[model samples]
Target: MRRTTRLTAAVLAFLSAPVAQALDTQTGPVRIDRIAAGFTDPWSFGFLPGGGVLVTEKGGRLWYVAGGSARQIDGLPDSVPDGQGGLLDLLIPRDFGRTRQIYLTFSKAQGAGSGTALASGRLDTEAGRIENLRVIFEMTPGSSGGRHFGSRLAEGADGKIYMSIGERGDRPAAQDLSRHNGSIVRLNRDGTVPDDNPFIGDEGAEPAIWSYGHRNPQGMAVDATGQLWVNEHGAQGGDEVNRIRRGANYGWPVIAYGRHYSGQKIGEGTTRPGMEQPEFYWDPSIAPSGMVFHSGSGHAPWRGNAFVGSLKFDYVARLAGDPLREVERISSPETARVRDVREGPAGGLWFLSEDDGALYRMVPE
Candidate 1:
């Protein structure tokens, strides 16, 4: 039998949390609460400073969800919703209360080409619109086609923002530092280059690049100790979870654990000098995306564990241990294509489903 677990009235105004159905999980019995639905390719979401939630849809739309209701947020700029482009990731800066600013990753047009771009704007809650919208960063040498737009945002404690850019189906582009493709970028909160960035002073190099040679890095997070990690998608197989190292090369085209979609071999057999290997990898390609490292008392049993949403596997993988193993597979009985997994502000767990376009929360039953 299912039951409703109600939070205090104060908490209700924040998330509108309601009791849900119990399910058997590896850790224990838990309940899942449905947040808001009726989304069209909801790519990412984050908490608003005012206890609401902002969801970015791939079709150039943003929805403000709160109190069991949703409102369409206006002022979203034109973004191409192609193969893998559109409004991707959204983040509320830590200083949101003071700044009332939020960041977004979207695909911007460049001639006949498009590339991932980052923008920030002031959220005018009273008017339900964004003001002063500006694109702060754009991947250069924009390429045609939208097979890979690797866009995820994570803010460092230093108040700097980090983002991932895909190679746009151009394998060789990842090896070139002059172009922004296939790289992790660091920028000042205002979209200016960080002076200490690895390539800042180098001639003919992309100054925003913090790391290179990645293939569609879709998820990034910073742990409590300030360590950064990324979950990347592999071509046909070889999805990887890696620890981000400054100025390091991930050896995408040169070395890989997976093969080409045409059944051809890839790279120089997965070992190369000066190339960083993944801390963990999936051979058959789970098509990993959203990720978060859980720690805190709200979900005590999940503390110190890492959760990753699997696009191809239709489940969420709970990974633990230094070597990083998938300890549990949290799957919705109805086969949810998990797109994003996040650690809620209250220490609970939340995820977005692409299959049904619904938001769900996992909590103690």
Candidate 2:
């Protein structure tokens, strides 16, 4: 893979400019105010019905946040934290108020190996615990190695749950329909494959595949218009933010704008007629991990912008417009690796720090 030099201080400083008066909290762009701190390897979070937040730590712990205080919640299962495996994503069911259901994705140890696992349970808010926890699904048996656990969950307007599985460091597996690895799988709310899936009876294919040929997709969200969007890490310098579609092929090892870590060109080339291109991509790799559309009162001017976490860049990026026309990157006050970004119930931007493990709330400043 080609080794691109790091950005210079001057260049980084220019990119980290403070919000101007025109975009200030009262009249200018959106601003963020830090509210809470001190978390370890925070990964994903979801808001509770009453007014609390449920957060997951990559180190295998879950916490409940309310009124600026955080407390560990019991009833979490065992998780494999080796390599890139651990508690990864969390979400509240659409009928959360009625069913009290919560869903999560994590790396589970199967014998001596590990694979991604999806599970759900009831959140007993009054008791501050999870109940009736059960494994909904596990990656096809016998897969090992931890580089790619494409784990992100999104519930579509149609009420189907969509989950992404990484290629597990196996390039060709992405093109293989027989395996669930490296594909977007859609399931009914009860964890069964939807009968209307595209690959129902093809030879050796999993019926849950909605789209194939994806790398490690970590960020996923549904927009107001009900369109699903995904952000994935590229090989060396090609990080992409794509608008996902059913029955589509997102060229991975086959075609990439990025090169290998050894500086070698990846796949055949960047463009292929059948494969769909990303709506927006970053060269020199920001190592984007989490993404969410910004729609809150705190940042009025940025109401429609997309806020994404940058691990390699050590900052948060604000992408504006439908085709993502404008780009504004901001450095986090903590200067730690940003693992996840989400909109809080208070219309503020919530972020998790990967390295220092702290939870930060960004409100309009």
Candidate 3:
């Protein structure tokens, strides 16, 4: 367990608002609506090309939502669903019209061992199945910790896919460039290491390593400028939002704003000379999971803000600032745990609840 600084009782209470003051919106205030229900620990959701959505449940199930009906997708790989290990992120290829490809990350089990795996397949919407599924990448061997599988996938402007891996709860692994755990990795759309990756020619290091030092990163998005951003769970209170840089080291375990759960300080101190500082951090631990940049036209002033989902605080936060600032927070009354949030394809917003397992759509009122 890690130690986190406690927030003031008043601040904690303020975060529990059902409906707070509305921000200046181009089209008035925003409201959220329930699109569907009856999800069992839903982890992530992705919108398809023509008004359908694919969702993954933590208990090894994939579902298709269309015409207001939820149907379980068939032909999914065997998954290890134990203690935060299960189906995770989902991404439809940017060129899906031409490629017909979909990517998924999940925990695979073999005997008593489990590790994260990334796979891609051609999705057959009419047949309601995934075809030609293939393993694109797998975590390193002997690293089987159930926690900190910081897995998220996003395609970069260069058409390469970027994946984030946590340190598997083993802090020392963050400094090990030779391991894929605790690193941001870049791979070609076809699952090969890009020749231009930061560690391309390094002998002992994985060629896909982009940046290192991360815990369980649940939220990741690339902005219009092609800059990558991520939000990760900190030990106790040091939940951080960071701008990912190529070849740079983000100091975790070694230097963190958070303490151990047992009320002990972590590593040496909070600030180190070479380590990058977080743009924004939550002291009492918001338990941020999903994140996306608000680039849709439905919310005018929100175009540049980053929206983050919180588990511990049960709110969606809007973060602003070139250096990142907490502009506002919107609490959800439906559930106490928000698993994921994304800007919808139709200029609205979509989010998933981890507890009650429901999908919500937000639009300008």
lDDT of 1 by residue, 187-291 (tens): 998899988998878899999999999999998888777888999998878899989988999998898898999989887889999999999999899988899
Better of 1 and 2 by TM-score: 1
lDDT of 3 by residue, 192-272 (tens): 888888887888998888988787788999887989999989998899998999888888878888888999999888888
Spell out the clash pairs found in candidate 3: 1-261, 2-260, 2-261, 3-259, 3-260, 3-261
- What TM-score should be assigned to candidate 3? 0.91
TM-score of each: 0.94, 0.89, 0.91
What RMSD does each model have against the real structure?
5.0, 7.8, 8.0
lDDT of model 3, residue 82: 69
* Candidate 2 residue lDDT tens string, 1-365: 01111212222333344432322332344455444445567788888887877778888878776664556777776788978889889979778999998888899888877887888888886686789888888877567887889889988988988887888888888888887778888988778888889888888888888988888888888877788888888888888888989888898878888899999999898999899899988998988878888775655776777888889878888887769742776674553688888887768777877785556666665
Residue 189 CA displacement from its true place in model 3, Å: 1.1
Give all candidates' CA lDDT scores: 0.85, 0.78, 0.80
Worst 10 residues of 3 by lDDT: 1-10
Question: Which 10 consecutive residues of model 2 have the lowest summed lDDT?
Answer: 1-10
Off by over 4 Å in 3: 1-28, 110-112
